[model samples]
Target chain A: MTTDRAHSLKQLRRMLLVRRFEEKCAEVYQQQKIRGFLHLYIGEEAVAVGALAALRDDDAVVTTYREHGHALVRGISPDAVMAEMYGRATGCARGRGGSMHLFGAAQRFFGGYAIVGGGLPIAVGLALAEQMQATKRLVACFFGDGATEEGEYHESLNLASLWRLPVLFLCENNFYAMGTALARHAAVPDLCAIPRAHGIVSESVDGMDVVAVERAARAAADAIRETGKPRFLELQTYRFRAHSMYDADRYRDKAEIAEWKKRDPIELFVARLKAASVATDEDVAAIEREVSGEVERAALAADAAPLEPISDLERDVLAKVVP
Target chain B: MTRTTYREGIRTALRTALHDDPRVFLMGEDVGKYGGAYACSLGLLEDFGPERVRDTPLCESTFVGAGIGAALGGMRPIVEIMTVNFSLLALDQIVNNAATLRHMSAGQFAVPLVVRMATGAGRQLAAQHSHSLENWYAHVPGIKVLASGTVQDAHDFVLEALADPDPVIVFEHQYLYAMEGELELGPARASPWRASVRRAGADLSVITYGGSLPKALAAAEALEAEGIRAEVVDLRSLRPLDDETILASVRKTHRALIVDEGWRTGSLSGELATRIMEGAFYDLDGPIARVCSAEVPIPYAKHLEDEALPRVETIVARAKELVARRG
Candidate 1:
């Protein structure tokens, strides 16, 4: 197999893994194994897998609550991610942060910030640290189209632009914030314009195309590294699942969902690989089976993981006092 | 020993922090060009340059959240909010990110951020500018809240808060900027977490912090003149509550009066009173009392503002009432 074939195969594997992992999460959520606002990255897998593939090992990533894909693609262990969802002691965050707050310092995956636009400034600050330290490490900040309405989003963009911080602002434009659609929430629905207004380089990409997202992310990341200035990418994606377990998704039309599903990222990528002769039908089926097995193993490991001791509930509130 | 104003003490601490540590930087609105809102950071921008002393746009949540991120990214960021009221614009970052990040991340990260803000109602700054909302921050668990009342504290607490591993919020009393006192220059021996007994007496105990500390001391002086020796316990640290010192003072005095500039309902003073009732209830010869701000918005007028906040007269009166009820 060629190098391009290998990369395409890896990307397919990651996207498949995220899809199967989230599907398992939804199934378990129905069985009451994992609880509390479970926001799945069902249709938005390409945005996380493709965009995160462009980052350097030293670079940072700050993402929103719908971040299982981001965590998985950022190289956090599947067992740890599943254990966090299970609220187990062996989880990445030791079961403290649930589905909405996955964090891993070693991976430089800052957090799965639950607040709409809360992670933007944190990303800017991380980039600001890199700039101040005179390092080449960049930070990738991910948010939804809904975050554009937040003042922090505007403030973060202005600061990132003004300071010339090496930041890649990845706007996962999934069209809705919870139940409120972008048309209803934002005064200007064009999110790319908002970043461009802040004097930052901005572009919109087909988020459903994994190759397109990866190309855009790499270009944006390169631009930020070369110029030490922030760049923004509005990945036009969509969430196929309900906003959370509680959401009935009354706001969106079934027709619109069906229309978006026709452009399903994984199916599109699989077809592209097949047409390009990069992967065969057997190859795709094998990748799907492998990912399904991996996800099942993760779920089993998470279920077997022990609960964090209740006596340590007050631990880690502050840094341990060194004697 | 040098006599310095609270404003100068704060400036010295900031300057010292910047000079001593390479990782320390200041970022806030008007902190660079306009000095500080209360001139607490005057002349440091010219000395340290713009990078260390940053002047940010009028966006509180972003800058404060940036401070948290900077702290997480291995820099000590001292973010100054013009006043307690303006700090509310950044409350989400303060409460959600700064305060809860360490715990939520399960100790993977600790935000060593120092947030400074002017607090309390005096100088007639009106409701928007003058608010004693330290209690709101003190109610939080992860972050440590400090109230600097004396010139010595204003000089020392900033340095100590910067050294703290967790996020620390230092509430500087707005009215205390020009307050002059003898500050023994050098390393401070007092810990930021411990409550100090500024004036030791046995008749009654006046527990207070921040802008109300001076008023509590003045009340103690007045009680002294009335042959009632009142002990004054300055609660420098609000979050941890220094329950041992408070209980010790209450046990000695046998009477307690909590003076807080915040409203009576859900105030730090109420927390202090409850602690006393829990630990020193049998030791108390009389019921615990508190002199808190009136439950209305602090008015603009000088008289009304003075009447709304806890004052010397009210503290004196409350102290006397508590002491008289003793046996």
Candidate 2:
């Protein structure tokens, strides 16, 4: 709906932010500044950035553990997300939610759920609430390719379609469900077709291409917001990093990894911008420098932030700043 | 005070909650068209239609997880697990997802979700369906546990739980459904977090909740004939144990006995005894006691099932022992 320049620039900023933030996270994890399973969204930035760009600020989002990218794209400050990864009190969840559970209520980012296929039903529920209240807000749910194997995913799709709730199921088909390749796990290699079984409108697009992802996501998000019906989008992508910090480089062949790495979403987007004369090489480098600066500043702030005291451990267990 | 069965009281609460809030809805196996496995949602499907009154696939873990998700997503979701026995299939979602979401999110999210299920023994239901596992749910943090023992509680607890900003589990006794009584569906208010004094006495404090509540009340009525006054404390909320209520009663009676329908070993009774030892040990004049289910699987036969669960006679005997030993 918006102009092509605005969309391209927003996508550039988001993709760069995710890449830089996660690269910093990887470095921090090595330095022990961050702990827990840090699943980086290094090569899969287009799915979160492109899809989230299609959503409004009031619209909610639910995602899986690989969610640093989702949080950044959904408008959570880099400082808060970085501090959360550092387990600092200034973090988004006041440092209680680490890498796997980043939550930003202000932005309507429901959570970064760690449980596989866990965010699906939640998105459906949120959509149900919106539909019941007659609100125009839509719920965007992001999960991995592996989540389709989970019963919650199927159940959520059926419930959403059955109720005609306004929700978008965005499956980040990164070709793996935590080291289990989609080919090995899924009977049908195509994940989008699965939603059709639930009577949901489904589409698959190349996740490495930002414009394609944004176009498809915008169309799907608009349909859900206007019609109060669920839509599914499968973004075929791949992860350049391991499943977690403990994962060794043993899941797939190096060439396959290299093959997918060549289609790097961020790099291709930057190249496309150069070819189309939308932005110069200097402009792309300047954007990279800007993201690196933001990541460094966030890391510094997080390093300076205080660790949550043990006394307040029992606090915030039952109640939150109620909406 | 309008008269209603325990089943009808719960239904009224559901009807009221659904009518009051647009966010509140029900989901579980047979909760919609089939009218629920236990008939708790008998007419909700007709009144609310399939949108508000939803029937889920037999995927307990996913549906329960979805309820947690739905709550996190700003909806008040009430999930029914046919019975407490079947809830085990979704225990991981309950314990790991629902119970830990708020704390794990560092207060970013508070799951206003309620999970309802039938519990305790009595019906000729076999071992799988007859076990009372409130103690297991109570053991977890980040979740509030409730047991509805009266018609008022059956109606009041669901509304209160729905109002809470945290996850709550309501254990509805299967046998209590048929029991009839007046149900005044009152406005939602915080029923004090502490235990309630069902019947006051001076000899021994009898702490019980849910299925054992009626048996304790009956035991109290019978114990009155024996000249031993037993103070019956109904523990409505189990997790955030109204320790003050139990401790004050223990101080008044100087002796205590916990009546629980759960098994003897590692039960809620065990936790109550430990709490008494820690909080009211100095105030106690005698040893703490408990009359829990026998340490065995609940048999299918009606007679054996009655023997395995805590009955009025058994609670009376346990209370008499505590009173007699009040040296």
Among the numbered candidates, top TM-score falls to 1
- Runs of candidate 1 with Cα error greater than 4 angstroms are A1-3, A320-323
Best by DockQ: 1
Candidate 2 Cα misplacement greater than 4 A, ranges: A1-3, A320-323, B45-50, B185-192
What is the per-residue lDDT of model 2 for residues B182-223, given as tens digits with 9 covering 90 to 100? Answer: 777566444735579999999899999988888899999999
DockQ of each: 0.68, 0.44
What local distance difference test score does each model get? 0.91, 0.87
lDDT of 1 by residue, A168-249 (tens): 9999999998889988998888888888999999999999999999999999998988999999999999999999999988
Model 2 C-alpha lDDT per residue in residues A8-64, reported as the tens digit of each score: 776798899899999999998999999878998889998888898888999989899
Q: Kindly list the per-residue Cα lDDT of model 1 for residues B216-324, writing each as its tens digit.
A: 8888898889999989999999877788899999999899998889999988878888899899899989888889989998899998988898888888887777777
lDDT of 2 at B212: 84
What are the RMSDs of all candidates, in order? 1.4, 2.6
Please give the RMSD of candidate 2 to the true structure: 2.6
Candidate 1 collision pairs: none
